[model samples]
Target: MGDLVLHLDNINKSFGGLSALSDVNLHVEEGTTHAIIGPNGAGKSTLLNVCIGRLKPDTGKVTFAGEVLTGRQPHEIAQLGVARVFQTPEIFQEMTLLENVMIPALSHRDGAFRLNATELLSKQGEVREEAEHILEDVGLKDMMMVEAASLSRGDKRRLELGMCLILRPRLLLLDEPTAGMARHDTNQTIELLKKIKSRGMTKVIIEHDMHVVFSLADKVSVLARGQIIAGGDPQSVREDPKVKEAYLGGTT
Candidate 1:
């Protein structure tokens, strides 16, 4: 097997008496796209939250790059090279796209969100150059000077991705990336993700779109009732009986 990058062992979580995760275990190989799929309330987001340090699991451990991350803070985990793209776009609607991208790029370089006005202005050109290059890569170079609020849904998602890429993260976790996208936009995202995969950035995606799942995932895991019922390569997992039942007789 490839060198493991992220591992979850016996992860469990709950609210009151409702179980969100139960003995959930997952292994993500380095430089691979691992997709996690489940119906609503199947604990997919909870598992991701645990992995990214947004929620501390009631029990179990999360390890990344050989270091235990179970108790680390979200920023601490990010410092360890993890980035997440939420279901909706996360950007500064009032700011220019270039400004939105440059903020994180600047933070990545300066080690935090503190920079004097003079120093910021002095470094603006360099940071702007880097942010522009990333925007180009994400196919948003033309929108650099435009207000973020004016971009289309797909473009907004692209901008959010650009923000994450500014960190040069080793692992990217995406939750429902194409949820509200049209077919054309979804296809565009697929092509963009294809490029990202070619660059060897490991990704763990939680999505309902089988087309998107099969398009990018190197391995697939299906979650149901807060547990993984089937997992393997795309073809095999797609044909698994338990997965079919979990998708309500294979409708999903």
Candidate 2:
């Protein structure tokens, strides 16, 4: 076990007449993968949005590394080392894969698209090297020069992962990183995530793929109707009666 890197206490959120999340409580330990699994409309993504400061909770608190994060803006949270990868892969359509990966690294060095030509040129070598290294780490080294929009769905996801990796975030929030991939690609994605966890990065993932969740998560939280009903080790959660009844539909 390690220090609690992310903590959510009694978090609640609503959209007019609908409650998206209610009394959600979660803690992710440093260097572990914690999975959030639930059926459709379970408020899983909404919870993530709140955690990363894309949405403010009506009540409760979000803390990261001892700092209160309830009302901070998304970019502000990113500056504090919280990175989010959305469900849809967000890549620069016209940019080369290498260039796409370099953007975040450059931002880290020169501050988010604020660089003048001289500053940009001075940091080019280090930023490209770092980006290329991340690409290699994510199995996209050979595709460095390809236009991002031309990538296959799986590779697009890899490129997105590389972008997040370049940030070296303390808390990584992934929304369905494996969605819509072929079986082989899904396994590859899982392997990539495992490699990331091995490097001691903390991850909190929202996923519907049970196989991936069971294989990679050290702990699992079952969310249904905007609340967590079970939280524990993967095997224990897989065996929980309430979890089976609620999300698993009586299947283990």
Candidate 3:
């Protein structure tokens, strides 16, 4: 573990009198994969939303690489080198796989995407080269020219991951990276994440699959009823009674 790359402190959020998060604090060390696991509606996604500026916390502070992210816009946070992969695959359905990846790379370099620059972006040798490289890294090079809509759910997830990789984010947050994958696809996704981990990219993952969590997470935090009940190295957190009871559906 290195210096803290992401920190959430004194966080609180509510919806019409229902508390969604309460005094939540989290720290993700640089170059490590941290898994946030919990029962449904435990505020895992909400926390991610807050970190990326999609949802405002009633009271809290989000810091990434020493910058306060609380009031920043989602795109602003992204421009600052934080990228998120949603629970559902978000991609350009009509665009070719290569083009889909190129769009982000172009936006990342130009600071914003322009419709008129679409053709010129495709013609950029450097951007196209990197996009092809990213597609290959995510195991989708063979289908680089195919439209994104033709891909399977697993392939789409891989494509989306490739899209994120083009920007080379400093911190990556993944919400259910393998949500609907079968065992085979899940294992492949895990392997892909491990590869990313080796490259020292910090990641915060919200995952429901215990297998995926255990396989990739160096540290684990369990959220229950909108609060963290246990947190530590994966093995210790897995053995914590509160975690077992709250997230694994076992008695404490």
Error of 2 at 153 (Å): 1.3
lDDT (tens digit, per residue) of candidate 3 on 1-252: 768889999999999999999999999999999999999999999999999999999998999999999999888999999999998999999999998998898888888545663365546999889999999999999999999999999999999999998899999999999988899999999999998888888999999988888889989999988898899999999888777777686521
lDDT of 2 at 11: 94
Worst 10 residues of 1 by lDDT: 113-122
Ten-residue stretch with the least lDDT total in model 3: 113-122
**Positional deviation of 187 in candidate 2, in angstroms?**
0.9
Best by lDDT: 3
- TM-scores, each model vs. reference: 0.95, 0.95, 0.95
* C-alpha RMSD by candidate, in order: 1.6, 1.6, 1.9
lDDT of 1 at 91: 87
List residue ranges in candidate 1 displaced over 4 A. 113-117, 248-250
**Candidates ranked by lDDT:** 3, 2, 1
Task: Provide the clashing-pair count of each candidate structure.
Answer: 0, 0, 0
- 166-233: candidate 2 lDDT, tens digit per residue: 99888889999999999999999998888888778889999988999989999899999999999999
Better of 1 and 3 by lDDT: 3
lDDT per residue (tens digit) for residues 1-252 in model 1: 399989999999998989999999999999999999988889998988998899999999999999898999888788788888988887899999999998888778776456466664545788889999999988999879899999998889989998998988888999888888999989988888888887677899999999899998999999998898989999999888888878836555
